[model samples]
Target: MSVLRMQGIEKQFSGVPALKSVSFEVKAGEVHALLGANGAGKSTLMKILTGAYQADGGTISIDGRQVSIQSPQDAKALGIQCVYQEVDTALIPYLSVAENILLDRLVQSKGAGLIRWQQLYAESEELLRGFGFSIPVRMTVEECSLSEKQLILIARATVQKAKFVIFDEPTAPLSTKECERLFQIIDQLKKAGVGIIYISHRLPEIFEICDRITIMRDGQHVITTETARTNMDEVIGHMLGKSFAEEFPKAHVPIGETLLEVTGAKGGKVRHADLSVREGEIVGVVGLVGAGKTELARLLFGADEAEAGEIRLKGAQLRICSPKDAVDAGIVLVPEERRKEGIFVEESVKNNLSVATIAKWSPLGFIRSGLEAGQAKELVQRLGVKTADISQLVGFLSGGNQQKVAIGKWLDTDASVFMFDEPTKGVDIGAKSDIYRLIGKLVEQRKGVLYFSCEFQEVIGIADRILVMFEGQIVKELDREQATQELIMYYASGGE
Candidate 1:
């Protein structure tokens, strides 16, 4: 029997339909996959199922009985739990891992009495150990990395004895080894007869683990089929509504003289790193999590102070002590964590776009609103940022649009060297293409670019050269023609 079912589910936001007449089901012990592009309504449907958003029209059934769920508590009461894509918002930063994991159970067990800290710690430790997680129970959630937080959420769901669990892009932040561990946990959950709804853009993972697949496009369901019956090509065509010619649209640009060079740079996790980027070139940096890719970017961008290094731009040495110093030296970084580090969430799109160049629009300590608005409007059109108005809060935009704003903020400056850390991490395929084209444009303008990502395919597709880092060092450097997935992976995994 099917453990969960939804019929004619519909949802809308600000008069725009997010999900239309969507029907879905999951049987006991089944790993069901949900596939879609950004803005394809997959998240909206799951939000409704979790009671985070009420559907405009729909009927939900659990165990063949109709039910009404109006809030997250109601959904939990019916044995439904969700691990959303944005992990930071899902967890409380100030609380310890154990407290966050057993919060619900602790309240229930208390029954108006004092709490039992000893039992809670013991239970939380045992639960984590069972899942192969070694995180300390008393460690604050704020101190944990993104992957650790993801595992914590999964452990919490498992402990809740959820009959139905929804995992939304759970592997986006995980390394290969970490992903293998997650798959193992999922295997255990499946053996326990939990109906799972898995959502992801990574096609290979769906084939490897999912039993069935459901494709959605433009707020509508397109197809639902057994995984063994359909191939990647068929699935991609269904999700996109057409055949995709190439996964990566690489552009050719002539390489020029060196624009930026680093020698013996050491900061944070990065140790004795050396690299160079020439004008009209895109140099890709590929590494696993904790391999020091982000640390190198931060050192170059002056987000972290370098203890020992020589940084040169066009044969001129630079002393960059902070982000302001880096910007003044004609360098900028588009950070990986867009929501937390890159954007002013509560501000307007225009304000965000003009943030880096606000001083340029101010004359004699007076702000020139007209000039700022004009620049923001031009960037919005050039970057194809879809928004109702420039005054709209940036927090309300979709992931793709938000990323565009993050990159656009840097365009208003005169910086000639650009560094992007996981620029397309959570974006969809179409948006990723857009970002690639933008990078190509930067190269065509004779700007030097450093692109860092964990995905080898992205490094191979967009870069003129690829540098593999392992254990905080550049272990191998390969030209565009010589780099491949296997070769990059070998060096990225510390191969000699």
Candidate 2:
């Protein structure tokens, strides 16, 4: 059997240790789960394995022979492939699905032959069929939904037929059916003798498919054990270096008068919707994939145009033509696609945290650098954003920390309504608690909050009331006391 091993892997960023002498391995035909809390070095190790980042010290071996992987091309040449969670960075939006799937092959044959469009599309379609999913081969990736884009990335990885594959948070954007399909695909890969490294925060999935699990904490390897021998609690304990309490930090904030009201809102996939949020109340918008929850959030935030609707804040009708208008009217949205729409990844954390309220520090056409830095530092500490310093690039932070920055940007604003769409999609349990705590603080301040997510249990634990959407409309509304996972799913799937 083939084996991929990294012994004593070490990596650092700007002199700060990220991974310290970490060791990991996977054998042919086994799914290995890599578990860690955010900033726990899981991503750093994977990046070294896939050659996205060069390890400062370590040795990698494939089937007992040491190999050097300094770049993505080097990794690919050595039969290694990865399906990263950030699909946009890996995919060319203007290219068709077929083209993106066959890009590597096209590059290898650049000067050898003419383009074979028909054969290419056929191969892509065949690969998609093997996954038991069908997406139009000719459709541009930009037109695809996040779920579809994830599928395309999986399909492309399959086309490579690599000896080892890495799937990073692959199910974060998928529906239940799609997630099951991915698990089946993993089974097939295992039967074909491919070593798979699976990284995810969903413990149930790790137990279901992974044969062995490796836990890391504070940039060091904690433990590696057979999945059957260990429990989820043990794994989480190792990841966090402490026992975990899986509870939403929902505070007891009394619901007050309605702060924001929407009537007959229509735009994007949101055909018709009416909703209301009261001060200090969290209104959860729950839906299955493509059920228009995100569309509704976008429309309310003015990210997309509202074809027809009445939006009122404090009983005053407001005309919101853009995001600026929404912000001006004391409304803000933390979008689902955080890397793309929320924070500026290339900027420093201080700038990202202060951008939403930049006007507060800028006067007479000049920015008060000292004041901005002080406020940024305070917010970082308040939100628990893990970074070396405020000057560090936001992109270097872990997924959970990046999310905190995204939400923190609006915290200093005078915004009365806070909307978060899939806020915990890629965050670990610990990070989720921190985010929930932040939301609770917002509620304590008597602000209206909207929580839009497909995670029913999360909504049940956090929201005061829940609204279920189906077929681009709000089909049902239930108080928190009346909400259940089954009932939410039933309405989300268009139940009568």
Candidate 3:
């Protein structure tokens, strides 16, 4: 039986249709996946259902009863809770774990008409223990790791007793081991008659967790089918309106002379590193949380200081004390957090695109808005960045589209050596394949690129060679042809 049904939902933003006649139904205890590229109307549809946006046309029926959800509280009262892609920010940082969990329903004392902190703490600890999670109950939100924070978020939601839970990109910040734990928790929830709406760009995860899958493209519902009835290729086929074979292209371009060489460099979580990457080749850096992969990029780009070491580029010793020095030398680092580090939020897509190479385009000692606008517009179309206007504020864009803006910044600058740290993180599956092709394009231009990813599968797909980092050191390096998940896991977990 259908527990929730949404029919002919229609929404528009500034006279532009965001969702057109979209419809779907979720059965009790089913994990229904909502799929789409960035700006593909998935967010809009959810906003309508959760009362963030009032639909212009459509009917939402819960258990065959017509209802009007005018606010988030209405949705919650109807047993609806949303866990968006950026769920971390939804938490209160100053609150303790127990306080955050039982926020409003803290057990109260009767006689004194006062709040009961002790009762809240004891009940919260028991609630967490029900799930076998042993996290510190008194710890503040700021003290928890990303994985801990995610688990706590889920726990808090499940405790709400919501019959329908919407999880958006819950695995983005979790480790593989932690992800396994979450799947286990979801299984328990399913047994308890809870329905889940899992939204993620990870195709494999949809297969692993979802009972039914719904594909959306360009703000329209493509199709909804059973997990066993469709293959990955067919799903990708529907997403792009055609086939995208070889999603991860292995560049066979000849490896040029060594373009980057580092010896004994130590910064952040990185220590005593000696490594080199050749021009026109892709080297992947793989590691778990706090493994120093990102810190290595920071040191190389001069965002973080080196405790001791020398870096030589093209056989010439270079002193890169800051990001400007590195960029002037034709090296670029695309940081992991696109929303925070990649671009300015309030700026136009055009301005953000030109930020890296603004000095070159402004060599006449004045800004060239015309040249900047043209270049930004061209790059957006070339990179398939979906935006109605190139002059739109980047903060209004989706996660995947925003990432393309970050990549466009470097492409505009024509950076030769690119460091891509989680370039495809938080992006939909469709955009990931596109970014992979862009990486191939960079290598075709003889640009040396170093890629870092938590997903070992992605490393195998793109890297010519894989360097595994653990505890601030490169413990293992394997040519792509020789690497395997078992091997990568062995190195990552200190098995080898």
Best-performing candidate as measured by TM-score:
2
* Residue range 34-149, candidate 2, lDDT tens digits: 98998999999998988889999989999899999999999999989999988999999999999999889988999998998999999899889989988999999999999999
Candidate 2 lands at a TM-score of: 0.99
The prediction achieving the highest lDDT against the true structure is 2
Model 3 lDDT tens row, 407-488: 8898967567899998888887778887888898898888899998888989999999899998888889899989998899
Residue 268, candidate 1: Cα error in Å is: 1.8
Query: What digit string (tens of lDDT, one per residue) describes model 1 on residues 1-496?
Result: 6579999999877787778999999987999998887667887788889888899998999988999989999999999998777788888899999998987876687668888788888999999998888999999999998889998899888899999999988998899988999999999989999999999878899999999999999889999999999999998888778887787877787889999999999988888789999999999999999899988999999999899999999999999999999999999999988998999989999999999999999989888999999999999999988676899899877677889999999986899999999999878676787899888889989999999899999889889999999999999999989999999989998898
- Ten contiguous residues with the weakest lDDT in model 1: 425-434
TM-score winner, 2 or 3: 2
lDDT: worst 10-residue window of model 3: 103-112
On TM-score, the stronger of 1 and 3 is 1
Q: By the TM-score metric, which is better: model 1 or model 2?
A: 2
lDDT of each: 0.90, 0.93, 0.85
